[model samples]
Target: MEYILFQKDDFTEKNYIARHEEGSKDDYDITIKGRATISHGGRELTIVNVSVEDVGLYGCRISYFEEHQNQYYHKASQKVFLDVKVPPPEWRSAPILRRYNQVTDTIYDGDIVNLTCRVPGGNPLSQLTWSGCPNGSQTDLSSSTEAVVQLQFVASSSHHGSVCTCTALQKYASPQERSSNVTLLIAHPPTLDIMASPALPWFATGGNATVNATLNCTATGGYPPATLSWVCKENSTQNGTEGPSLLSVFPYVGVDDDKMVCVCEARNSYTAVKGRVFKTIQLDAEYHPQLELTALPGNMIKEHDSVRLMCSGHGNPSNITYRWEHGEWSMAGSNQTILNLNRTDTGNYSCTGASNSSRYGQLITVQYLPITVNYLDVQIAILETNLTEGDNVTLECQTEGVPSLYDFKDWNFQSYLMNDTQLLNGTRGKILHMENINYMESGTYTCVVNNTALVRHGSKLLPILHSPKLHPYRQASQQVVAPVNGNVTLSLYIVANPEPKPADFVWTKVKPDNASRNVSELASSAGLVSNLTIGNVRESDYGEYCCEVANGIGEKLKVCFNVSAQGPPLAPTGLHEIPGRTTAISTQVQWVSAFSGGLTQVFVVEYKDEAGEIWETSASDINDTGEGKNVTHKIDNLTPATAYNIRVKAKNSYNGGSYSVYSDVISIAMKGILFYNLLNENLSL
Candidate 1:
């Protein structure tokens, strides 16, 4: 029998052939390692201990004897192929861990880290996994000879001093696992803080003694310990104390040392790779008080002018009080910072702070304008107000002021109801001479004095002295008429060198029987005029009256007057409208008063719409203008945006008077046009 073998890789033809003769003398080796044997009378083939190299095709051929023709022929059976598979061996060592894309074991925060784990020399690739690296993610990469696992992550302080591990396993192994690990070192910056001991406001003593303050700095949670140092204005750096807590001592702090700052700087390898960290604490050091004094509006003050003196004080632990003094007297109860200065606030002024007794002072000068000197019976250089024609006169001005240096500009003369004109062609002295002064020159003359600080105008009336003269309102032949049960004022004008006092006038009532008596409580005087009021006049009072006046410098004078029966007051005149005081709702009307006919008089203002015929009357309260002065009345509750005619009438208890002439028409617009024009003018200005 012959056996043929073919490799399983290709099945085209036989790769090996062997012949086994029946009972042949030589033994034939048919299979590898002699593990192949033919059994059951050469009908079957079996292989033990199968290996990969035994993979091939096997077949057998048998030759039969031919009786008729003695030739050898072979018959072949079907061919069979063999194949082998081997399981991987168990792991002997742990997986090897290596860092990829990195050269050092330490890394800064936020740096990307890559680590790979590999298992080499495995028939089939083993399964790889990661452990211990909770912050990183893993990826599996396997090859025919090795199993690999790579882990990538961003490093941070939380991952500092952490172990990263990679594990390897096999499927055919009996629950066996091997792991390798590496420790990660993450570097980070530290947190810094600074503080001051014994609080702030470090005080200093008088000599070389002082209250010292300590400064401390601390750095927490860093890979390497941080170094600390102090920096201040006086020094660049100072030596620090031991341990994680750093300290430096500051000695002899003074008021001048206030606002100085101490800086604490912390640095490490991590900070070197990143940035520097530091903290600062400003010093609130203090000492005794120092004061400065100043004044507003200068040290020199004019009379009646205002000034303020300020005392500025500085100190530490500051509770300072100020005191003021002038000359040898202390300003009691004046413990304030500012003192308002006045005329009495002259002489040396000193100030001191309560914390320190040192005083600061300044000299204050007071200046004043010139004042006129007065002599008896002659005020402002004039002795009388009555003058005659062609009288030679001499005027003088005398004044006194401080600082001595002064200038008397000119002498000016102003006539009654006229502008002032300079006399003596702008003279520069206090005395002014005039030849033959007349009644036409009976006006005011002014002397102007100036000291470059202020100007003064001293005036004098030049009317010469004379005897008293009477100028009654009514003519001597005309009689004053008054009504029964009415009041009246007997008024007259007079001129004299000296004004008449209330006691200088006397009045008497003379009846038709020629009886004379002094009327009690009947005389009153104002300025150069006198009045005698009579109430409830009767037929007994309608007779004659005499008024006498006298002054020490003038001869006494007497006048005769008569009183008759009742007659109405005269009508008012000069009906004028005050446009500025008039508004849409009201109008201010003023009129010149006429005679009262020797009795009390009241006014009545009447108005009417210019376009209409209806008239309205308003009775005014009895305001007797004793000297026939202007009387003012207001008309309210009038319609706006309408033209109106207004007039005033004077009435007594009698019934003989009529209304006065009408005023020019006026219109009332919204807020009046004069208000708008005045407001616009002010705005433009």
Candidate 2:
């Protein structure tokens, strides 16, 4: 018998097992190693310990002999059909893992990992499966007896040290399974994290002397361990430029770490081959910001000039602030501020730049540049000093010259023909102190200042022994005609050789009520024209105003004028007369008081009978008390049963003050026959 297998695809034939019942004794390869096998069936073919060569279409042939007519002949039977198919895949060997097409058990994270498993031979075509792989993997079984399984996956941190298994089994056969496992080379990038070694209390306060920021970095993923690196950067420079640089190698924080940004980085690669993964984080080590101040127009600000200032510095935190400080004023901005420089702004200025952990300051001075005048400005406000012989006068002599050198400036006073007296001689500044000044010291005061090889002088005329003249508010009379509840002015002028300085003018107002106020300044000047402004005057403010001026030479010279705040007084009302005994003519009449004209006065009461008498009897009541009071008096010998009416008038010290005007009155009065029937009966008895 001969067993032959036919390739299903090509119908090619191959002899598998052969046996002879009767044949020559030269065939010796049968049943070698017991691998070539057969089972009990004349036509059935079975193989044990199968290999890839065993699977195909199989057939069995048998030969027989028969004797006929005394002669023996040989006959051959037809080939019987037998087919062999592959079973489910069974692992013949171990699985292989590859990274980047290289055989490696260590696959790094972010790498595509490849896995392959193959079972060479099985009947009925084995199905292949992967144990530790994504679902829906494909099995390759195109060949009748060989099964191939391949899988591809991306390596991740979770895949580290995990096992990848390829399994094969024949479902129809005894549930015997074969499997191969490969420890996955899950190479992953380094696990990266950083922290301040010594925790910090506060990260921002400009510069904190206590802050020493050291960043610790760690890497934890991938097969072979990962390495750490660091980069250093300065937020900015003194010129406000970003300084970005890296360190030569990984190292601990150095001395220059202050105001330096240390970036921690972690690196790793698949197969531990070359650098691939890079993770970085920045750490800030705070310190005081270096502060500098620079002014526009170069620091020496002239009066009425506008100056701008800028502050620049560097710190660990890139976010910085700029503030300008002069005295108690501070402004916040990016790095610049502006100021309108004036005489009051001459002082030391400080600019502060602040950062997270520290602050820095810069100082500079601002003042008026030296004024360049060809000659000294001997400015005497008024030629009439508005002073007297005994007045202590301060003669001001101002000029433009180098005050630091005495040769630049000098002061002298001289009369018409008297010899010049050196008053002030100083290099720093020039002024004259004329104590107990007399007429002899009155003339022209001169300031001599050297102007670059030229001796130039400025003169101011001075006067002595003059009094201040007074003038009311542009009115013919020396009285200020002030309106009620309105403002008024009592101005005065002086005709002295030198005008009085603002400090020399004094004024006092003696109110009609003698109510005085604290000394107040009401005088001002506009060149040679000087006057006092009286504001918000009322009728109660009506009184004499005395302006006194004395140059310490004679008694204080005083000028007096009058100002009034007068208006109409309210009308008096509620007037009535009380009746007495019918036999008696005595009666009492009373009425309310009206406007006092801002003064203590009296009320004159006049009444007459309705019989057309013009003026019957009139009486007077001294209104020595204040206004708003009732006045009553006794009238003797009054005839009863007579109709009468009374009227009143009020006056103030102000000339032509207010009196009752028609019906602009808020009052009432009662004058009628008094009820005296009982009194008349008693009188009759």
Candidate 3:
């Protein structure tokens, strides 16, 4: 038998060998790498049995022919061994339990929460269970060690001291548990209640009152505190801080009752809770008696006027009673007092205001008196006299009154006063006799009576007569005077009733119809008068003359006088030759003057011529003296001149009512001269 073991790079092998009798079949057994092996032929190797170790190296030997040819290598075999190992089973940590806690969690009632428990570091994980107050009030969980247990219901006062717990379970190690406790505390704030006294009761006069009240409040348990306050409803102020907790308010001394409200408020620090309470207090005010007085037309009343007085007052539930002095009077209602007075009622008066509770009164006074005036009467007089130029005149005034009259006293009449005097007498009845009655003391006068009530009321007009009338007389022709040249003087006499009286004398011309002309006034003594000279007298001065006398009071009287001129008649010059067939002719005649009254009369013209020497022609008369002045004439009915002499003569009544002088003879040629008569011709020249 032979056995071998060998080593390879990554394996080992074992071989076993045996030699048998040459003729018998050889048998071999071997094990390799966990298998068993066997062999039989000498020169050939075969696996008869195998084992696990016979896998790698092998050897075999056999002999049959050629025995002893070299006893070589009979058989060969191989063996191997195998080794195996298993790993230990896997390991892991179980779940851990987590506990959560809440310290000052502030929650209101009816709030839900979930508490968690976690288990870490466990193998194969673990399961979870919730414990503590189960009763279906907490949530359940499974399949996980980290468990969340939920408190589904709210926390309440009944839930106080309760806990929510979670537990974790694993296949290894100890069980884990976690817990949280909940405290259900309700935070309710306080409520306030208020009350008041005097409670709707009526208060009368002199009634005393007292008030009593209380404030009640309640608060629930909470972490922080609350506050309560009392206040007045009207002002909304905190009563305890601003003023006294209890207050008393009074009405005016005489007022009625009223109602008032008081309030209480409550508040908390942690919760928004506020509460209020209210109460009402009733109060009645008392009254005292008072008085008011009045008078009609209060002061400074007029004379003979009347007035009224009144007094009134009021008290608690009603007005007070009124009483008047100096009469039995009592009144009710708002009008409690009264009085009616005239001038006779001008005196002091008193009134009283009274009630069942109180009384008061007052006093007053009044007065009366007369009417007045202030003036006098005055008189003025004008003495009667001739009111001629340069005459002395006097005027006086006299006033009638007990006291002397004032300076403003006035005397009035138809005329005004000229001088200041108490007694007035003058001409024209405006004179006062001061022992002598003269011509200046005659006229109308008046005396005026005056006073505050009467003005310029009394009057008297008197007449004074101390004047004479004088007049002049005249006797002359009735025609308008013709133009003449000379100085002429007429004489007349003045007659008057009062001899040697101061008078106004005047001389004037008069016509036959008695109308005067050329008036001239002069101041003189009344009597017969002489010539009133007229220088350079003309034909126009040949009219009648008269004299007049006046004393400024009555109608004037007059006397007439005759005046004449003595002068020769002069031949008329500037006569143009008359033309044949002329209807009328006018010629101008002029002459020179001789005596003072020349040409103061009428004139006559006559003419005769040869071949027809005829008796003196019919008279052609011109009434006026040719006193060296020009005068106009119109001669009619004359034939053409045939040589003629014309004669003219002056005439006057002073010369025995005849011709006074003859003019010189004048010759005129009538041949070849046309004679035109004014009655048969147009004389427009």
Q: Write the per-residue lDDT of candidate 3 for residues 358-451, one digit (tens) a residue.
A: 3212211111111111234555544545344234545565554322433334333342122433443232222333344433333244544443
Clash list (residue pairs), candidate 1: 6-57, 386-464
**How do the residues 1-685 of candidate 2 rate in per-residue lDDT, one tens digit apiece?**
3322311223222343544344332121354335543334333333567554544444444444443444434333444444544444433342222223324344556666666666665565455677765433454534644566667776677876667677666554455466767665565565556555455322433232334445555555545565556555644211111112122322343325544454555444552464544444444434445555666766655445567666666655556666666667667753444445455565666655554433333222222222121222334334235677677877555554322233436666666434556564452245566678765666777776664434567787776764443322222234455666566666565444344566666767654546344434666653223455666665556678766665444455567776754444445565665445223345566666655544544555655555555854456554634444677765565555555455555544545554543212111122334445755743321
**Per-residue CA lDDT of candidate 1, range 1-685, in tens?**
3333322334333433333445553223454436655555455556679764565566665656665777666576666766444334436665777773234466777889888888775444567887778567777776755678788899888887777777777654445577767777777766677777766545553453245678778877666667777888664697564347787776656666677777887777777878876788887765555666665555555556555656666665466666667656554322332333344445666675555322221212121212222111111564333455455676777765543455777887786425657475756686777766643466688888876555777888787554557643332333577677777677767766566777788877755754332464677877567777778876677787777888766458887677777566667777777778777678787877776665677777788887878878865554867535888888888776667877667766655543333444444332433333644653211
What's the distance in Å from true for residue 489, model 2? 50
Using lDDT as the measure, name the better of candidate 1 and candidate 2. 1
**TM-score computed on alpha carbons, candidate 3:** 0.23
Judging by lDDT, tell me the better candidate of 2 and 3.
2
Question: In candidate 2, where is summed lDDT lowest over 10 consecutive residues?
Answer: 237-246
Candidate 1, residue 172: Cα displacement in angstroms equals 14
lDDT of each: 0.63, 0.51, 0.41
Scored by lDDT, the top model is 1
Better of 2 and 3 by TM-score: 2
Which segments of model 2 are wrong by more than 4 Å? Answer: 1-79, 83-108, 122-127, 134-136, 170-177, 197-208, 234-261, 271-403, 406-685
